[model samples]
Target: MRIYKVGGAVRDRLLGKPVTDIDWVVVGATTEEMLAKGFRPVGADFPVFLHPNSGEEYALARTERKSGRGYGGFTFHASPEVTLEEDLIRRDLTINAMAEDDQQNLTDPYHGQRDLEARLLRHVSPAFAEDPLRVLRVARFAARYAALGFTVAPETLELMRQLSESGELEALTPERSWKEISRALMENQPQVFIEVLRACGALKVLMPEVDALFGVPQPPAHHPEIDTGVHTLSVLQQAALHKQPLTVRWACLLHDLGKGLTPEQEWPQHIAHEFKGLKLIKAVNERFKAPRDCQELAMLVGEYHTHGHRALELKPSTLLELLQSFDVYRRPQRFEEFIAACEMDARGREGLEQRSYPQADYLRGAATAARTIAVQPLLEKGFKGPELGEAIKRERLKALKAYKENA
Candidate 1:
């Protein structure tokens, strides 16, 4: 059996990028042979094993055939007869199809190295169109390597567009699609993922809520970008520029979903879009089965982002209510995430990227001021039960009022 370092490890190494994980492909190896050699079998559908010592994944060189539809509708064949080149060709992209042997020699059966040199994202073979998930995977790769000037090959994009039109995207499970989306959000240029998906019409099938924002108009005075979709992409870019976490980036993307639903008569002024957006956010969360933290933060940013923008104008009680709504005392980190998301929203407009968002500090200080309010003082005044809770609220509200005044 010959083992070779394959896929991302080889690709990233040649690109001068950090290699986080190294996947291995064992050619001419059987499950019995692997098990005899102390390799632990882990793959349920294919012959994937873990090294006895390193515990790293080592999958057998295998080929896949389109069995049905969607991403998971594939039949994999792994045997001593399957060639390494066959395994490589079944990969999603050319850059990911390359491999490195133990002797430090590179395998370029599909010209992956040449495409990498050309700064292009090309499919390994025509079989790429068989898997709908490749469309998302290619978009994600585009997002990850966008800073390196990589562009999708025109032919590859046409394949993605064809896949989009084939209705195969509808067969994707929410969990699988969300896996790609969430990973893409953390990439170097997450907005490029969205743009690439849109270019191939995958966004409309995967995220119709986000797609609807494309041609929707917004007030040019506040959003010089004018298009709600463009503004959302800007916000995602700002989130990445600031190195914000996944929760913040996701909130920024979904924060403006309501704007897309604004009645044409309402035009650029979405007076209560915040409330309207909560429904859209809920739909996305439920559809994607998003994590509780991501869903909760997206919902909060969607429903209260305007309140965040208007922090300086809100009354003391309103500020206290907002803090309590975030449950800052129990979950202070989430509050920071909320503020970061809102700040990205404020600075995402054209020519406003460098603009300061003092509302973040204002609200942060309000939370701090409220946190400093002592419940002991109310207890010392003989307050009990619900009365004590009410008194504590009053004191916190009074403190926030003072804090607002001082600011």
Candidate 2:
């Protein structure tokens, strides 16, 4: 049996990028031989074995045939007879189809190295359309390599458009789709992922709520970008630029979903978009099965991000209510994430990208001020039981009022 380091490891190495994971494809290897070598089988539908010592995966060189729909609807043939060329051609992108042998020999059967040099994400063959997951995968690669000037080949994008139109995207499980989306959000340029999906029509199928935001108008004075969709993408870019966490990025992307539902008569003014956005956020959160933290932050940002923007102007009672709503005392980290998402929203506008968002520090100080209100003073005054809870609330409100005035 001959093994070659394949896929991303080879692709990244060729691009002068850091390789984090390495995969091996074994040629002229049978399942029995792998089992005899003490390699444990892990693949359910194909011959994939973990090395006896290193625990690294080594999948048998195999070719796939389209037999069904979605990511799992495929038949695999792996045997001693399957050629490395046959296996490589079944890959999603040309850059990912190259392999490296043990002797350091390079195999570029499908001209993957050529596409890599050209800075293009080209599909290896027409078979790419057979798998709907390739659309997200290609978009993610675009997100990863966008800094290096990599873009999806027009022909490959056409195939993605075909997959989007084929209803195959609907066949993908929510868990699988969310995995791709969440990973893309953390990439170097997450907004490119959204743009690519939208360009290829996949965004409409996968995330209609986000898709609807693109053409909708917004007040140019508040959002210099003017388009709600563009603003949403800008927010995502800001989140990535600041190296924000997944929860903050997810919240930034979703904070403006309500603006897409604004009536044409309303044009640029969404007086209560925050309230309207909560329903869409709930549907999106439920649909993707986003983590509890992500869902809660997205909803909170959607419903109260305007309050975040107007922190300096809000009354002390409103500020205290906002802090209480976030449960900042119990879950301070989530509150910090909320603040980051709001700052992204504020700075996402055109020409205001570098604008300062002092509201974050102001709100943080308010939380600290409220938390510092000593319970000892209230207890010393004989405040106890349910009355103590009310007394603490009174103290926090008074402290917040003082903090607001002092600021």
Candidate 3:
């Protein structure tokens, strides 16, 4: 059995990046042979083993054939005849196709080394068209490499366009699509994915609702770009620049999707946009097979347009009431995530300097006071069970009304 380092480990090493996961390609190694050598077989669909000592993945050299369409419809071949070069050739991008031997000798038959030197994400072969998932993969890679200033090769971009136009991307499973988009969202510059998706027409299939936001008009005073789509993209870029969390970044991308469908009559008059946006955000999350908590966080961000210190004016009772109403304990950290998401959305909007809002310090103080008051043991004061619940409800409502009247 011959072991060679493969994939991201080699790529990252070449780029002077920290390598975390090490993948190995084993040449001429059968499953029985691997098991005899104390390697544990792990993969079911194909031959893959875990190294006995290092515990790193060691997948047998394999070749693939397109059985139908999209990502999962594939047949794999792993035998003595399958060369390492053949396996690398089937990969989506050159940057990921290079491999290294135990002696640190690089094997790049596809000129991946040259592409790396040129700072380009080039496809390994024309066979990239066989897998529609490559389109999303390349887009995500572009997002990851954007800070490194790498551009996708023209031919690769053209292939992506062809796959998008042919509706091949539609054949991808929702789970696979979500995986790539989620990874892209995790990147520091997800606008690269947005830009690439727009260019290739893939955005239409993955998120038509978001695509509808494109060119949808917004008021001039608030959004100088004149379109909610452009404004949303700008906000997303801002969130990325701030290196926010995945949920916050996703919220920024989707915070204004509902504005496209809202009836626009005048300036600062998109009434119920937040409520409408909440519904649309939930729908999008469901469509993408997101977890229930993720959907809730998205809804929270969409519903609460104001964030950070502004949330402090909401009154402790009102904030607690909202939290308890949503069963926030079911997803312990969701409320904090929602708050972060809302803050990112608020900060992303353009022309924030001209808006009349409370000072950041005031907002922070209000929020802190609200949290303290809400968390206090009001029920412990000679109250029990149903009575305690009723008392808390009445007190919460009273607090909300008082806050509203004072404001």
Candidate 4:
């Protein structure tokens, strides 16, 4: 059996990136031979094993045939007869189909090296259309490598569009779709992932709520970009540029879903859109099975992002209520995420990206001032039960009033 380093390990290495994990493909090897050599069997669908010492994944070279629909409907064939070329050809991207030997020699039958040099993300073969997940995967790769100037080849994009048109993209399971989405959100250019998906028509299938935002108009006075969809993308880009956490990024993406539901008569004005967006955010969260933290933050951002922008003008009582609503006393970090998300929203407008967002600091100070109202002090004053809670609220309101006045 000949062992070769394959897939992402080889691809990242050639890009001068730090390779975190290495995958191996064993050519001319059988399951019996692998087991005889102390490799522990791991895969159920195919002959994948864990090397006894290195503990890295090593799979017997295998070829797959499409037997059904979706990504999981493939039947795999593995044996000594499966050539390395056949194994490589099954990969989704040419840049990921190359292999390396122990002596560091390259085995690039698919011209993956040439594609990598050209900064292209091309498909390995037409079989790319068989697995719908590759469409999301390629978009994710575009997000990951966008700063490096890598783009999907036009023919590959056409194949992705075909997959979308074929309805196979809808066949992707929620968990699988979220896996790609969450990873893409954390990439350097997460907005590019959204753009790519939109270009390939996958966005409309996977996230119709988001897709509907494209032509929806917003008040130009508040959003110079006018298009709610463009503003959303800009907000997402700002989140990534600021290195905000995943929860913040996700909140930015869904903050304006309500705008898409505005009545035609209300074209540029979406009164109460903040609260209107709550259900849409919940729907998206339920669809993706998003993390509780992400969903909660998105919901809060959707319901109260405008409140953040109005912080400076809001009554002290309103500021206290906003702080309490966010549970800032116990979950301050999530409140901070809320501020960051709202800042992204305000900054996402055209000609406003570099403008300062004083609302963030205003809310932060209000939170700090409210937090300073000690419960122990209320208890020390012999306030009890409802009276104590009421006293604490009163004290917090007083502190926030003074804080806002000082600002």
Q: Which stretches of candidate 1 lie over 4 Å from their true place?
A: none
Residue 151 displacement in candidate 3 (angstroms): 1.5
Please give, for residues 308-331, the per-residue lDDT of candidate 3 as tens digits.
435555665655555564454454
In order of TM-score, best first, we have 2, 1, 4, 3
* Tens-digit lDDT track of model 1 for 1-407: 99999999999999998999999999998999999999999899998999999999999999888899788898999999999899999998989998899886999899999999999999989999999988999999999999999999999999999999999999888899899999999998999999999999998988899999998998898889999999999999999999999999989999989888888898888788889888889998998899999999999999999999999999998888899999998899999999999899999999989999999999889999999987787788899999998988988988987898899
What candidate 3 gets wrong by more than 4 Å, as runs, is 263-269, 306-333, 350-364, 371-387, 393-407
Worst 10 residues of 3 by lDDT: 363-372
RMSD of each: 1.1, 1.1, 3.6, 1.3
lDDT of 3: 0.75
Write down the lDDT that model 1 would get. Answer: 0.93
Please give each candidate's TM-score.
Answer: 0.98, 0.98, 0.86, 0.97
- Give lDDT per model, in order: 0.93, 0.93, 0.75, 0.94
Query: Which residue pairs of candidate 2 clash?
Result: 213-229
Give candidate 4's root-mean-square deviation (CA, Å).
Answer: 1.3
Order of models, best lDDT first:
4, 2, 1, 3
Summarize candidate 2's per-residue lDDT along 164-196 as a digit string, tens digits. 999999999889989999999999899999999
Better of 1 and 2 by lDDT: 2
